[model samples]
Target: MYRLMLHGGVHVLEGTFVNGAFHKPLFFFCQTTMSTETDETRQSLLLEQESRHTANQHTHTEGAKMPNRKGPSGASRLKKCIGLFFEILYWLLTLILVQFWKACTAVALSLMLTYWLWGGWATFCLMIAALIGIFYNLQDSVLYFPNEPESSRLYVPPATALGIPFEYVTITTPDKVHLSAVLFKQRAELAPGVPTIVFLHGNAGNIGHRYMNLHELYAMCGCNILAVDYRGYGKSEGVPSEEGLYVDAEAAVNYLHSRSDIDQSAIILFGRSLGGAVAVHIAAHRHNRDKLAGLILENTFTSIPDMGSVLFNLDFVRWMPLCLIKNKYFSIRKVSRIQVPTLFLSGSSDELVPPKMMQALFRICGAPSKQMARFEEGTHNETWRCRGYFSVIRQFTATVCRPGSNVMEPSPSPTPGPSLADYLGRVNMQHQDV
Candidate 1:
């Protein structure tokens, strides 16, 4: 059966037409032989349609003629105009429904949170006003959730829907857990032993959502980037845990190792968020530094406790005394052992993982080549601010991936995000001039 869709047409066919195809015409001979029961059914349908149409027209006429005269001398005409204005506004909002869902959700959630925090029905009475705010904002919430519209317009690949170029490969871990990953190769003009970078995605979402960043790295950085899905992420099999993800990472490494064309020494590990933990673990523990060229960590913390303290705004969490619990990505401990060159990047305004901790990790990394780039205004996951995301990465790849050219330089500090006062000040200044 074909789907009835909004853009295609409005199909309000009901009753008998619901299941069968109304568009299918009968052969001339078959039409002539059809029974009287069908004629009776058609007549009943036409009468129902006519009655509904007449009732709708009558309702419309009555509504058009009615007047809301609240008082004898009050501004009744003004009231009518205002009512009409709101009716038209409602219609427009209905037409553009998706854009306003987030604002609505935010207002509702805010009021709920406020009440939940405040307690008592007396203070909760203030929530009524928030319902009005929620009315407008709900539209924005809807817009954000359903397959972000802009990303939909991108060219996604077929083997997987994410649009990254791939050749299917299966890898077995040293412990023999099978894993799946897609390899994205660059159309290169480079020397034969070009560096290959394997991407380890942040914990949580899968690989499809990361194509925008991946597309840039492949096109500009010109590295053979293999973005692997951890266990239970994307199309990959098995459950995800600290140990499971590490096993997955090892499998991905061994897969790269099996390839004859890939230079073992030129392999670079690029990890984002939680992937940084895994990458640092592999780089530090596995005796493969001679075969590994470099490592890059973006928006990553030093240990889980450090990240937890940053998240909950408590320093004591970071001071936990456990052996495994001390390190965030545990990069701080491992960074000292990592002899390969490294690049660490963090956003200053990162609320989740504090930038200070990332900076601390940068200082601890004992690499012949090491650089820490700080984006002063960037939020968590926003690589866009750090030299278009691609530029800093390309520079890092060139510096660390090449054997003799172990270049490392300070990345420029990023521009700040606009403050609230700045926006209001501009508006106030404009009005004062008049």
Candidate 2:
């Protein structure tokens, strides 16, 4: 049966040609023995049938070797597209969930705060709003809040109301900012070794706001007093800044030094609150140290960031970076460089600047002699009202300064420090001459 199948007529003969083994003579012989068919028709039919059978067999073999290749290729491309879509969807969902979590946390915090402390929470919300506003408009916020900048016409200092005659003087800073100042002096001859107090007042009001302290210092101590208005505060030109205020202080010192009536060697820098930081900054300068007699700081904080923590008493702001605080009067760092004698007057009950910060400053002082006068019953603005305030100032000056003692002691070569202009130039603060 197998041999008969192999020899099975013309179909079996066609297989030889299809397999590429038929000689031309064998094919011609097979055609001639088969029939007298036309050569063209027989060749054409045989070639067509053989070509069709060869193609079908080749395709069947390929299909067997690589089953489902076309179907899987199309399916894989579809799978890739679906996977990319789902990946994008997952990230979108994650982003939405994160935003929703933040919102929920904020709402929960607000509700808890409102429940526990209604008034404080309201104030906190207001403060948050104010901070957001400040972040958006820092320049205007610094110009406006915490400081009351009024025109000179609005406030006038009483020069002679307390019988200690004071002269209204105008001075110019190195930056050419004009400042209004009051010079308080005894009409009578000043006692020997009596110091001139270059008073720098606190943050909020003009120098005239300290009339009580001025009157008391003059009547009680009989010392020379010169108080100047910082820029943007009580008739001074330009906006207020930490460096601008420092320059105003320097200008005040220069004005006092220029005066022949006032002794340069007996100049004492007296500052309260913000003024205290400015005074310390002035006294820390290598150029100003020789001319200064002594230093006095009352109710001043360590730094502006520390003061913010103290002021707000909030955990969130307690960790506020010092770089973010625009008005960074870092008195603690500056006080360690002050070479003169220092007197730190701390009110036990100071609401704004805590007594601990003052004590920290007192301990860090690098002065030859430093003392702290504690007012047990005093507060921030009323430390001068303490019974021994004037006496402490008088005694401190008498002990630290002497007549013709303007000569500075030979210390280590002083490191160069940043000038007021240099400090202000680095930040986003601009002050124009008026």
Candidate 3:
């Protein structure tokens, strides 16, 4: 029997060799034929592989020579266009609603003011005020622009964005609304008399909106910060009302006061814009006036009516009866009663709240020793960027609030104080069965 084996396309025929002589010449011929066939097959395979490799290279080169388009794909562009259209439509609808709301509010206010101008009695004014207060119950929805994250919206936590050590505080207001706040602790051991600033932010946005302010306070002002979001803002619960916000501010003050690490007497209430009004309201309250060390108001307006007047450039808005307004942050009336050492800071070129209004507020401020810092050519948001912003605060704070100093009493005034009776009457009227 003869055996044939194939290895790497090499053919081998094995047989007993008769003294180095071929047993069958045919066998040798067959083996040589097989070997030749195997060599030819191997060559064909190599040629085939080479041809395939060349074809692949040619195809790749052709693909590479094609035009390079850098923008989005046609499908992606269509999608983006659709999304933009929807966004525009949504804003358009929102604007229409806002315009309608404004029209209604303006007409109502115009009539009330017109009547008051035509010798409307206090009783008639009170009736008009009640109706206006009910109308503005949804005012928060219009005023507050919360930075709530959804879709492409951006929101960064205070600790991460501000680059400061902070704690998320959940405060429950007396009305049982859960409010979100950020408390930035001092890095070093706080000096005995050094204070913490309870930062009350403006009408719109959350506590995180004040990250720059908090960062500056932490780095330059040498004061720890505790900033709270009002109801319906950020993570806070409930709708915002004038009284509800006051309760929120009280809750913040109380939270800091409860902490053993904090100096209750050294706590300073710092407010900017609408927050300035909140701080003034809190400092003016009978209970909180003696508790807080000082008040720092920056670029704040007098009241809502005054704000509407300035914002709209309407002379009639200024003449509107303030008692009829709900959500009245009447800082002008309240500022005159806040006896704590106060600092009134404003930008000379503030567009939102006129510098003159801040000056008027400073003039009427009942604080025993108050200082005014004006940044010429500074706009509303740019007040802190003004020169000597932090220095002025530090200097003013040092004199007014030493750790061991006694709480100052409210200075006696020759003129009668602003009455909250009309304001409270309006609020109570809203709750009455009508």
Ranked by lDDT, top first: 3, 2, 1
Q: Estimate, for each residue in 342-402, the C-alpha lDDT of model 1 and write its tens digit.
A: 8776777786777777777777777777776666666777754344445566666776665
Q: Which stretches of candidate 2 lie over 4 Å from their true place?
A: 1-133, 136-153, 191-193, 316-318, 404-434
Q: What lDDT would candidate 1 get against the real structure? A: 0.62
Worst 10-residue lDDT window for candidate 2 reads 425-434
Winning model by TM-score = 3
TM-score rank, highest first? 3, 2, 1
Query: What TM-score against the true fold does each predicted structure earn?
Result: 0.54, 0.60, 0.61
Q: How much is 263 displaced in model 1, in angstroms?
A: 2.7
lDDT for each residue of candidate 3 in 1-434, tens digit (9 for 90 to 100): 24454544454454434446544322212234443566676577457555655665576579789987787799989999999999999999999767655535434545566666775676466657556654565555555565443410135354666555678889987778998888887544553335778998777767766676567656655666888888877777886777888889989999888887767778899989888888889998888877888889989988887887767678797676655466678788888787788888788888778888888888888887777777775688777766666667766667767657332221122234322221121110000111
For candidate 3, the 10 contiguous residues with the lowest summed lDDT are 425-434
Question: Of the candidates shown, which would achieve the greatest lDDT relative to the real structure?
Answer: 3
lDDT of each: 0.62, 0.69, 0.70
Q: In lDDT terms, how accurate is model 2? A: 0.69
